[model samples]
Target: MCYFLGAMPLQCVSGIFVLYSLCLLSFSPHCDGGNILVYPVDGSHWINMKILLQELHTRGHNISVIRSSTSWYIPEESPLYTSITIEMDEDVEDFFDVFLQEHLRAQRDGTSLLTFFKLTKGFLSMIARAHLLWSDATNQILNNKTLVKSLKDSQYDLVLVDPAIAPGVVLAKHLKLPLVLNVRWITSGEGHFVLAPSPLSYIPVPGSGSTDNMSFFQRVKNMFFYSLVLFQEKFLVGPIYDAMCDKYIEGGCNIVSLLQEADIWLFRSDFVFDFPRPTMPNAVYIGGFQCKPAQPLPADLEDFVQSAGEHGVIIMSLGTLVNTLPKEVTEEIASVFAKMPQKVIWKHKGEQPSTLGNNTLIVDWMPQKDLLGHPQIKVFVAHGGTNGVQEAIYHGVPVLGIPLFFDQYDNLLRLQERGAAKIIHLADVNGDTFEEGIKEVLYKDSYRQNMHRLSRLHKDQPLAPMDKAVFWVEYVIRNKGAAQLRTGAYKMPWYSYHSLDVLLFLISSTTLIFFSIIVMVRYLCYRRRNTKPKQS
Candidate 1:
């Protein structure tokens, strides 16, 4: 090395040193990058997971994504990560869209127990089918000696997976690699309830429609919602995963146990948007990790936004699940947007609404992050998914939420409570209500101001959410696993964790002592009365 440096010019040597330093700046603390094997859920979950992969790839980490052959959002080919395609029984994405449409239609008619039952049945069937396919795929992969040997040879540092599904958790365990969960939802409900201290009185269960502050009735409702989650897991989801584990893993396992075994949870939630709740040390918050500064818009879209001028533009998207609203709902929404002064860019995927206004531009897909970040954007008409809500907070854009299904109401309720958004329930979404909701958000300066405050709070963090996420992932990699940070709470049985057995024992002892004292006092009183009467 000294001989070569002597042969080289001093300027050339300095230039080489400078270039090497520049490369080091892009990497994490550890110089040599770690290999990350990812198993991501499809739809919006995949979108965020893809962002993480891009960042990791930039930092010189090797990434491999295990995806189902029938996945909709996760492409078979991507520069971000090499794909390990698992053969699926059928397409799972379409099931969600169909179920969403049916749910909307039921809500339009009127919400009743029958509607709830029907909608719930569809939702459960979707979950059951998706898990069945994924479990089968995982079983196939595990049983195939060639594929099993190949994955073993890869020697991944960690398995970063979205725990919304069971395959990744099981796969990570089967591979005996350190597990890191990129999660908001697990199989049944929000991930935190499973991993941290979640009090039913305060921590609102997803789909409960309860807030952090709860009334007696609301708390009761939250418990019921929480019970539903438990029921779904115990009956609907858990058995499938357990059956798969029994086939492949030693000493038959379950999904919850595997998830609990995860080393680090890169949770996609922030206290700024999410209610302040108890969180574990290993669970790192990365709420808006996927958000970035706005990019230049396409020429036509730019022209549309610029045409709005001072009125500014409104953008609406109902996440990836809802492709099209019911016909009546669509016409009502289109009519409402038509009457507004602001130009509207809607990510609609149905037949052209007859009532669509000239001011509204409909598209199949949108640059949601860029549009939210755009200065010309005024109001975000959203379905209140976590991604949209976080992006809205990141961009300081007030939301006019029309929550359709699945934690959407709970998501919007947070913003509504913060006075940054107005929620219009799916059943009540007509032209008049939609127009009034939009006008309220558009005219109210407080909505904008409140959101700006949230934006400031969310941005005031010491490290960017994405950087924090990458750091935790690398922390796990660098240290083999983060066992110290992970709490042993999950290992405790429900009775032990809640201290119910101790309570039962204490109660039993107290009752026994009280009764014994009463009996002894009665006996003493009787003896005293009898002896005194005889002496007299």
Candidate 2:
């Protein structure tokens, strides 16, 4: 931007420029909302993203969303954002539904190393397919000259993307716009490993299911799990993005670097919910941003919860993805809930179980946050999704986690490490185990106390997490992206990033110097010996 608003003297330009920046800052806290182009991952990712959009809309930000035509969770029409739907051959939810059944069966089969490896393999397959679908969708957008031109013409200030899928990252780079990521998982793994210093010695990799303090073998397990993440990225998922970049994006980009190059990482993690770990300045923690003070529940639901009286209620939801468990497992859980004095509300969407309890209410959906914060609520039976876990922490409700798949166990472990949750392995899930877990979280005072302690810590933040997220998002728009916050390490190749090349050079130089000193000393000794013999 030029200092002069019009044709003016260069002498006055400097003073005007300084004043303009100060003026911009003075008024930028609230603007007619910056133009935000959102590329959101479907499914539960949309749930939290919708919250951000609602807030942005309230501030008068114009939002346009890129969605798949067959998106299961993202509806075609919404007042929050206009939709740009891309047609696709397949629905991701279709496979995910199939995968859920297989994944549950695989988990219930056993807990052996081989079984876990198989689970990893299955997960990689799903990730690879998902990436392919997103890449193809991105390619369609890039190839369409009209759409591409219009996207540019819209003059969006920045791209707000969930980096779990790299299509958005690739599209952001193609547009050459500032980027803000609503991210926890990227294409490879957790966002920290890509952008910050995550020494595996202490930081447990996702899917490893280890706590921050790990045993020797647990660390090895963590390392192995990390390798799987890398392998998935490099071999399984990376090539899809690479081909897209090669064809569509200028120059060439990889998903990992694109994620690292983002102007802001609105990380959905809090130190209270997560272990203490290194973070980047650009990585703003907006954990529990979706959480708020409980709103009034529906009259009928309130009546049900109030009927629990002193025993309080328990709520179970396995998220939108996992609609129902296998029949036998479902019956077992239903049976156990039937015997409990505390009432249970389960979010299930299928045939009612034969053993369903009189004291339980089954719903296709629930006001989960509202229920969690209710005074009559005592326990959360969760699948350990990050959103649910953070909400549980926000409401100070202890969890009985029956983690079904993908980072759920790890999320629960974070709570369990602090004694706020009890975990039961899926393979070990039965009536006895389910009942025992629920009882421990419900009856034990420590579980409630610890969770309450965590809730207090979470609530003690100076700025509401959502406000902090929005402020940084606006910060990117006002500054046109302050690249100074991002470190240059991500731009380096692995050899340079880790200093491996420097180490090799130093070793070779030291070896050469030592050899030369030895040779010089030997030559002097030989000359002295020869001269002494000649003199004699």
Candidate 3:
């Protein structure tokens, strides 16, 4: 009777087991949400981070985003995470505005060389402003006892930073969190040195636009550009970042050391879209992760596309930065579009061109990706921005690129090399050349075919880019920084990574052996001659 009283019903036993399993699941690290901090630099970088972070948030991770106030493309607030905005000083902000205006004017009015010079000056100004703003923000954050206390109390799991903004490194150090760098550009500048084996012999510099298949002279040119970039970053920009680190960090760290310690790097490119190159195990390519399926075009836009009938449509946009073209250039584009049988959608912010055609629709903004994905769209006229290029490739649409400044020229050059696009430089834009470029892309089946082939390869990944990125991010959390994936190359000196030490040793040994052989032969010949003469 005592044994029977102690026995439980089968259903009661099952319920107890289920409750115990649930408790264990709740306590497991993999099953729980992680705290993630995301900080993206200004410009198109915000778009890339938003896509990744939003997906992570949807998967139940806690997210916190901090961005500069000067960002032109401010993201909408999400209920899933906290948003922090850092404001720059009025003078710095004004300077940036003036610099942008001058830079754009240079792009429109000057030769490529002059444009490059102006842009270079503007870039230096931008670096200075970035330093000042970051310094001010860092001091503010450190001085605010409440903010500092909160950051310490929160205990973030990981900090995802943009390397373009150097101060983010110092902030990560202050928080004492593991770092994951999200680089939006294909080229990561000096950061590439520590991330992986980037041989300049094949890997072109950011603005050079040369491909991996370069001639002897081109390779030399590539090396020169590479050296110039490294010098600028190391001597010109490194001090600003170091100074910030010195002020805030207890031990103080430089940019090179900070990057070496990074746990993971997510590049906004893939081999299918970019040239094949060696990447570290920790480096992941999630190029088109931000791309989405085409949404239905607005009624007016749909109507405009349908009006063209069999000729299809063409979409032209110069991206967010170059909102307007020079009056003469605008007229050239307008005139070219007028001659085309297809309907044209041009995204322009400046005054309407005098040659504005009846077949063209000029708007301030267009859903670029959605339009690219449209079935009837035949060609994309673009400024060759990375995002735009990626979108055009994803949709298998051919491009007529009008590259202006920065990496635009390089980006178009790559596309042109791939037979997927043709480029007409902004400075060289005229009605005849612009018209020819448009016609060449439109009439040529090779351009469309190559783009389609690339699109297939891009989509053939084992996992979707977004899934791949999220899995790695989570993997880092689950594995506690995933140190095993890190390459020893980063820890090695530059000479060691390139086998320069081994090469130098081989060269020295060969020279010494050759010298010793020569000396021994001379001594034997001298002795033989002297002995023979004495005998005579």
Instruction: Identify the candidate with maximal lDDT.
Output: 2
* C-alpha TM-score for every candidate: 0.89, 0.92, 0.86
How much does each candidate deviate from the true structure in C-alpha RMSD? 5.7, 7.4, 6.5
Q: Report clash pairs, candidate 3.
A: none
Where does candidate 3 have its weakest 10-residue lDDT segment? Answer: 184-193
Error of 3 at 38 (Å): 1.3
For candidate 3, what is the TM-score?
A: 0.86
Instruction: Flag regions of model 3 displaced more than 4 Å.
Output: 1-31, 69-71, 75-77, 91-97, 107-115, 185-191, 495-536
Model 2 C-alpha lDDT per residue in residues 205-269, reported as the tens digit of each score: 98888888899999999999888878988999889988988887778887887888899999999
Model 1 earns a TM-score of 0.89
lDDT, model 1, position 248: 76
Across 328-435, the per-residue lDDT of candidate 1 in tens digits comes to 889999998998899999999969999999999999999998899889999999999989999999999999998888888888999999999999888898888888
Worst 10 residues of 1 by lDDT: 24-33
lDDT values for all models: 0.89, 0.91, 0.79
> What lDDT would candidate 3 get against the real structure?
0.79
State the lDDT of candidate 3 residue by residue for 1-536, as single tens digits: 22352497777778777999999988854725888877777667777777788889889999887755665665547686787776656445466657666766776675667667668767765765666577676577767779878887888888888777756667787887788888743222634555767887888877666888888999888887787677666776777777877877788878777776778888888877777777787888888888778999999889999899999999999887767877888888898899889999999997999998899999999999899999999999998888999888888999999886667777788788889999887767898888888999999899999999878888888988888888878877776686787767666777997899999999999999999999999999999988885535
